[model samples]
Target: MKKSVFILLLFVAGSLMAQETRLLRQPTLSGNKVAFTYGADVWVTNLENNITTRLTSTGAVESNPVFSPDGKTIAFTSNRSGTNAVYTVPVEGGTPTRLTWYPAGATVCGWTPDGEQVLFASPRETAPSGFKRLWTVSKNGGPEILLTKQWGNNGSFSPDGKKIAIDRVSRWDVEWRAYRGGQNTPLVILNLADMSEELIPNEKTTDINPVWLGEKVYFLTDRDWTMNIWSYNTATKELKQETKYKGADVKWLAGNKNQLVFEREGFLLTLDIASGKTTQLSISITGDFPWAEVQWTDVSQRASSVSLSATGKRAIMEARGEIFTVPVENGNTRNLTNTSGVADRSPIWSPKGDKVAWFSDAGGKSYSLMIGAQDGLTPPKSISIGE
Candidate 1:
């Protein structure tokens, strides 16, 4: 079985909408051997030795890290050049090199199995459509190959590298329908050789993130009004709804090979693709809100958005708002941070799945970054940087 990955193309349009379940291909499959950081920074771990190595030491933000086939090098996005561009470096240590200098930005990097080229999605500076563009660059940084005319992001190559799946925003000029329920986006796939694109947009539905296993293209869809697992077969062009969890955020874990792992109501669940069945992955008392963006229509009809953790294992998200964990696998979740309802969000996991980092207002400032271990059995430790 081959593994493929796709990411959500995040952008703001006519109305600040909230609805996304996306993930750039980070090298987490190497067990603790890989993990990407915010601002395009990449780190690799040796699971056998529990050795964590910092691959890049740049002040520029780096993110969305992917490992080479041999696990020797990593490709990621960096702003070292004053713009978000794709850069590659050795897993051990070295100076990073730029792959895309298009001036607009090279956001996401999907590495080929052979580690020769990277497929990515970026906003085009001169694109006529005013949306993002999807392109592929050589590992050594060469000419980019354009794939679509519409705004494309979250592009991933299959384990075999024969197929590429991505999330495409058909247009950037968004016409707000109403920030009540949710907006619509399309989950699309492309055949790398012929450059053919396929749209599997469900009725009045928006889906971001596309991953592949064997023949099924796994993606997150809000078709049932609640985001859950959905699969499409490129050969049959048919769609199947895998899970139905209402009022929850559902997304795919990077390395979950034959099973579909997603979060539902703060509990992580796994679905079997072949049989179209789902099972519980984990559960906790951590009461948290789903991430991406959502059309929050409160009684007053006010509109605001939220950020979700990529791991989907948190209950209370967003510091300054509320902070909670997804109930540890065993035992109750300890209050790591007793912040008084601060707005904290975007909790990401380290390769070892030990430490978690997120942006929050628990510090009383605008938003201070916080890092704590998953063993939230103790008071949540704040790993905010010292000014």
Candidate 2:
């Protein structure tokens, strides 16, 4: 009986440790595989078996992973070299090859319909530096060719590669939900042959992340006051709403020929083109998070609200939500409020130089005045300041 109970407890502990990770972003879909950005690295998961593998583990941020046309390679942007640039790695994982060398950073959008080149946006040659234009570089590495003279930040190619659907303006803050300002622009379908432009119907709402699927251009719009999937049929000139997500704005919409994948509230969801059905993809990530570990940090450079003692023997300051004092000519720096989880601010030295005072939220209900010994030898006395 004792052995059985012990085994049951072990099983329960294992189950609790297997909870799925949320907050995944920038999801791209192609066939049965999906790639996204998590923990500042790029990760790929196979939908068939639900096996997730970390592709890039660099210290720099890697984001916006777009699959190749054949789904065997992923193109993403990384700031590993001190500036954002384009890179491509095999879908199964391998050494990434840098493709862009311009000073201005490039953001990976998607692949050309033919899979011969990787599409990206950059303001390299633009005059004002605020306008970004779409450019493409060959997968084998060569000069990047400008797709169009018109300004474009993110775009997708048509099935035949003759035309492209692009968002002309990039918002300064994409997370500003329901933003209906002048920056809000309609998706532009630009004809490569004549440079003619066709604007999708709009009423000053934010429309972005255009993905071309079949004869329709699918995008995310805030026309209904929440960003959701909407589509426009190029053949019939008809518009339709694809998904009615009211909770969190759908972001980073990407697609293949038959399916679409996006992020909503930090979870990845997919929509089938034929059935119009949306399903959340279950993904679990297990690894050691070294950044989340507890470690001592030097707060000297972050010190604020400094005050000198009455006789100038010591100085008190607040840093990293803690109260600290440093000797003027000798002794070590003393941390008065060592509480790491509580916020302590506005520290000052007492007029008599016998004590230190600060306002802290240690009570968890309101800010309170905390008085402690000058040498941190005694616990602090808290007097609540009601909200």
Name the candidate that leads on TM-score: 2
RMSD of candidates 1 onward, in order? 18.3, 10.3
Error in Å for residue 11 of model 2: 29
Query: For model 2, what is the error of residue 35's alpha carbon versus the real structure, in angstroms, after optimal superposition?
Result: 0.4
Candidate 1 segments whose C-alpha is farther than 4 A from its true place: 1-27, 31-34, 38-40, 45-52, 158-162, 170-183, 192-196, 241-248, 251-253, 256-387
In terms of lDDT, the poorest run of 10 residues in model 2 is 4-13
> Which tens-of-lDDT digit does each residue in 282-339 have in candidate 2?
9987765566555566556778898889988778888878777877766677778777
| Candidate 2 wrong stretches, greater than 4 Å | 1-17, 298-387
lDDT of 1: 0.58
- Tell me the whole-model lDDT of each prediction, alpha carbons only: 0.58, 0.87
